[model samples]
Target: MEKAIFAMIASAVVGVFVYPKFIEFLESKGSKQEVNEFAPDAFKEKKKTVTFGGAVFVAVPIIVMVILNGFTLNRDLFLLIMVYGSYALIGFVDDYKIVTEGKNDGISAKTKMAAQLGLSVVFYAVYILTGGDNMLSIPFLKTPINLGIFYLPLVMFMLSGASNAVNLTDGMDGLAGGTSLIAFIPFAYYAYKVGNFGVLLFILAIIGGLIAFLFFNRKPARIFMGDVGSLALGAALAAVAIVLGKEVILVVVAGVFVFETLCVIIQKISWKLRKKRIFRFTPIHYSFTLNGWDEADVVNMFYGIGLVCMVIGFVLLSLS
Candidate 1:
């Protein structure tokens, strides 16, 4: 508990102080955001502003974690940090490419997927070597069912799915970060209750970092998290869920992410099947935008929906 509090304080202080300066630095370096062609007109004027600020938020927690937890490499912590850092690096490259080239295009989809898959393979190998069980916990059932050798592919899917889910959810300022903070609250409690103090501290640190980032990430965000923050956050969440043996519940608790991803999938499938698009735009949030809703309104609505889903998840978890 003491470690958690200390980490929170440290992360918050560092994040708040460092973020503005980082934004300025990026601006000076010509590292600004390029508005996507598919993005709303409202966002166009804000183009060339700083982005990828989530790197700072993520970094603070990791530094705090290492400093306080010491240098010993626990399997879980090692995987969490490695996956988080790797995804962040991938995002950084993408963001840097976009900013430097003055185009929306970053890394190609095929290349990015190849990189993510490679990282997933490494993560699974580490898990197996660390004596991590391949059994997945059923939400309602207390027992875990082993998938044996199939777990490798499953882990890869989980990691990749989570990464995309979060990337999809990053359509609005503070939307993904705020909702993720809410989701992390439960995971933090679960870790604490399960006597996983290290994981608890990690979650708490992330919560702190997100809270600090929210100061600038709210509506009309000063800096966007972009893919850097989203992918890293998603990967971290996956690692935590895997370690806690609560991967199934994560889908319920993070229903907002799932819904966002589903909207994209549904839209794509509908377009492919009927040669007609379902929504004005994919990811559902842009649907709201196309319907004349403000970004803040859509974000707030998602946050409300996230709260309800989280409550249900908590109730079900308690009952189970």
Candidate 2:
């Protein structure tokens, strides 16, 4: 745990300096924000800020983890980072194509989903082959459920679902990153309790890097994590929880994300079926903004909810 703290601090200190340069590098590459056409007008000012800041933060944690481990990779550590890095590649391609081509979206939705599921298959193979458990832990169930063959589908859904939930939540500054940082706290405890220090180290490293990223990511953000950050972060969270066998708690800890994703689904369904809308906006958080809530207020409010969710998740994990 002390080592994890060191990794976190190291990642944060390094990220603080490297991030500014990274933003500068993005600027040099002409990687500026290209707001979606339907996005609110307030987002116009963000056009000058750089996107893909996720690359820097993610790199910090990975590099720190490697160095701390004396550059060795155990099976669990390898799979953990494999999940993180691979999804990041998908997001990197997405962000790069979108920025370079000057498009609102880089890959088609179908293409992105395919990429996610495809990588998920690879991860599932590695996980099961490495003797990972197939038992699913529920918060209240006295017995753990064995998914066995069906765990594959769980892998696919958790990976894609978690990543996109964060992506949807990324509509505001400090929203996704801040909430995600809080979300990882309980997982860190679970990893340690389960004697999976590698995963704990990974989580701590991320927590530390996120601390630095959030400084720049706050309201009037200096940079955005873009798909690269959000997708990778979400995928990593799902992967971590899966490996820790705390899948049920992960959903509760990151409930804000699930809640937001549900809002999107409900909104779409209501619109398509009834020729009407549900919330004033999708993702639900944006509805408050449209109703005259300040962006910072909405972000803070979500952060508070995320904290409460994290506490609930921790308690549930303890009981389970």
Candidate 3:
């Protein structure tokens, strides 16, 4: 608990102090967000804002962890940092391309998927080799069900899905990062309960970093996290879920992310099958935007829903 509080305080302090400089640096470097052509009018106002500020949050935590906790070379800790850093790098490249080239289509979907797949495979192999379970824990059930060798594909799916889910949820200011901090609270507690201090410390650091980011990430944002922050956070969440044998509960706890992704999938399927669109826009948040809801309203409502899901996750965890 003390460690978690310290991590959070340190991260928030670093974020608060560093954010202004980071924004200045991005502007000086001519890094700005590209507004999608089809995006709502509200987004147009955010066009010139510097993005990928998530790097501040990501960097502060890792640097603090290494300096304060020291490197243990534990496989789980090593893999978590590696995967998180790798995804962040990919996101940074994507954001950089968009900012520099003035293209919203930063990287090819194929290339991104290939990179994600490679990372997922490595993560799964390392996990299994280190004697991690292939069985998944059912959310409301006490028993763990084995997936045999199918665990490889499952892990890939979880990682890819989580990354995209978080990416899709990044539409609003502080929406993704704020909700993620809330979601991580329980996971951090669970890690501590399980005596996984390394994972606990890592999570606490992330939570702290995000809290600091939120200072700038709030509505009418000064900077956006972009895909770089979103993807790394998603990967980190998946990795933690797998480590704690709580992947199944993730769907429920991260219901907002699931709903966002499902909305997109449904929109795509409906477009193909019926030549009709369901929501005014996919990801649901944009639907709220299309319906004339203010960005703050949408953010608050989504966060409320996230809090509810988190409470339910706590209940589920207790039952388990």
Candidate 4:
């Protein structure tokens, strides 16, 4: 418990102090965001914001976890780090392409999905070998649903979907970071309750870093997490749920991300079937924004929804 607390504080401190310098360093190197051409006009305004700030927050937590865990190589932590790192690499590649090549087309969608699946397969293999179960814990149910052969695909979907969902939710300032930061709190509690100190420590570290990132990530942002931060965060967030055997709780805790993804899917489906777009832009947050809500208002509303779900999830976990 003490270690978990320390991990959170240490990483938060790192995020608070390191982010400004990191932003300056990236800015010096001409590392900045390039707007997606398909993005709404409002998004184009963020084109010059320094990006890939996810690098510092993501990397700091992992480092803090290692130090707090006494440098011991726990199998679960290793798997978590590997899965998280792989997604970060994918996001980094995209961010790098955008920064260096000066284009929004980073890695192709096909290539990115392939890489995500490959990493998910590796994670599944390691998890099973490490005696991980094939059971999926459904919220509010005491009995676990065993997936058998279908488990692998589920893992693939969770990992891939999480990464993409977060990426999609990154269109607004602090939307992704703030939502994720709030979501992690309950999960960290779950980990602590289950005596999984390693998971708890890792989450606390992430929470700390995210808190600091949110400082600059709020309205009128000085930095953007880009696909790099969002992808890595989404993967890590999903990975933690999987590790804790609370996959269903993830849906509730990360309700905003799920809602955002559903909006995109629904919008696409609606366009194909009905020949009309459901929202002015995909992802519900932007729809709200385009509907005349202030960006900060949209973000705050989503945060409220996220908080409610987090509370609901924590209660369910507690009852279970």
Candidate 5:
């Protein structure tokens, strides 16, 4: 408990203290964000903001953990950081391309997906090799249900799917970071209950870093987390779920992310299948802005929705 508390505060302090300097550095380099062509016009002005601020908060936990724990990680901690850091690396590359090329399309979709999938394979192998369970904890079941051979694909999907889910949700100020901060609450609780201190500490550290990041990332933002932060956070959540056998609960907690991704997918399918659209904007959050809602209202509403989902996730965990 002491270690966890220390980790959380330490990470938060590091991120809060480092962000202004980091943002200035990125601005000095003139590394501004790239607004997607499909994004809301209001967001086009976001192009003036510095990008890749994720590198600070995303690296905070790992750096703090190493300073305290001494460059050491058990299998579960290894898997957690490995997945988180590697996904961040991928996002770093993607962000690099976007910033340098001066466009929202960063690296080819095929290339990005390939990197995510390839890293999933490596993480899966580590899990299996480390004697992690091949079983999944099904809600309302007293015993875990074994996945056997199917676990591999499921794990791969959760990793990459979640990575993309959070990525898709990062379309606005404080949207992704705020929702993800709420989403990790249940995982942190359950991790403590299950005695997964390593996973628990990592989650708390993330939550802390997010709390500080959201301070700057809020409306009229000073910095954006960019792909590096979003991708890493999603993968980190999924990896913790895998470690704690809380995958099902993760879905409930990350409901906002799932919903956002579905909005995008549905928008795409609807557009292709019919000459129509369901919402004025795809992410559905931006669509809220279309209906006389401002960015702060949308973010606050989603934060409320995320809290509700967090409560529901706890209810589901109680069933187990």
Candidate 6:
């Protein structure tokens, strides 16, 4: 508990203190954001803000952990950091392309998906080799569902989908950060309950870093986390879930992310099959904005719902 508290405090301090300097560095380097053309028109005001600010917060906790636990590096901690850091690297590349190219276009979708899949394979293989379970725990149930051979594909899908879900949820200021912060509370608790201090500390550190990022990323934001932050956060959440054997509960704790991804997927399938659109915007949060809710309101609503889901997930996990 002491270590966890220290990790959180150190990470939060790093995020809060380092972010200002990072933003100045980004601006000096001309690493500013370009609004996505497909984004809702209301977001035009955010153009040219410094981006990839998430990269700082993401690396801080990892560096802290490495310094603290270097001699005792465990498989779970190593895997968690490696998988998340690798995904952040991918997102960094995407952000670099967006900033330098002066457009939203990054790597091709196919290439990005391929990279995610390959990374997922490596993560799962390492997890299995390190004696992680092939069974999944279902919420509100006692028996573990064994996936046997199918666990590989399921793990890959969960990792990949988890990362993309946050990417889709990053459409609005404080949307992804707030939602993810709420989701991590219960996940960190779950890790603590399961005796996985490594995972617990890592998650608590992330929560702290996210809180600091939200300080700058709130309404009328001064900087953006870009794809780099979102993807890394999503991957970290997935890692926590996997380590705790509670991946299924993520669908509940991260309800907002699931909803946003579902909105996009449903919109895509409907448009391709029936030649029509579903919502005013695919993420559904922007749909709220389109329906007269302020961006702050949308972010608050997501935080509220996410807290409810997080609590429910905690209760269910406790019961099981």
Give the Cα lDDT of each candidate.
Answer: 0.83, 0.88, 0.83, 0.87, 0.86, 0.84
Candidate 3: C-alpha lDDT? 0.83
RMSD of each: 1.4, 1.3, 1.5, 1.3, 1.2, 1.3
> How do all models score by TM-score?
0.96, 0.97, 0.96, 0.97, 0.97, 0.96
Q: Model 3 over residues 1-320: C-alpha lDDT tens digits?
A: 67656877898898899999999898898888755433667676665778888798889988877766655546667778878888888888888888888868888888888888889998998898887879989865667899988988989998888987898888887899988887887787788777887788788889888988888889768888987899899988888888888988888788889988898899999999999998888777888877888888999998998999899888877776
What stretches of model 1 exceed 4 Å from their correct place? 36-38
Model 5: per-residue Cα lDDT over 76-96, one tens digit each: 888898998999999999999
- Tell how far residue 163 is off in model 2, in angstroms: 0.6
Residue pairs with clashing backbones, model 5: none
Cα lDDT for residue 229, candidate 1: 89
lDDT of 1 by residue, 208-254 (tens): 89988999989777888877888888878888888888888889888
lDDT of 4 by residue, 107-210 (tens): 89999999999999989999999999899987667789999979899899999999999888887888899999888889888888889887888788888988
lDDT preference between candidates 2 and 5, better one: 2
Best by lDDT: 2
Off by more than 4 A, model 6: none
Task: Give lDDT tens digits, candidate 2, residues 234-279.
Answer: 9999999888888877789999999999988998999999989988
Point out where model 2 deviates above 4 Å: 35-38
> For model 1, which pairs clash?
none
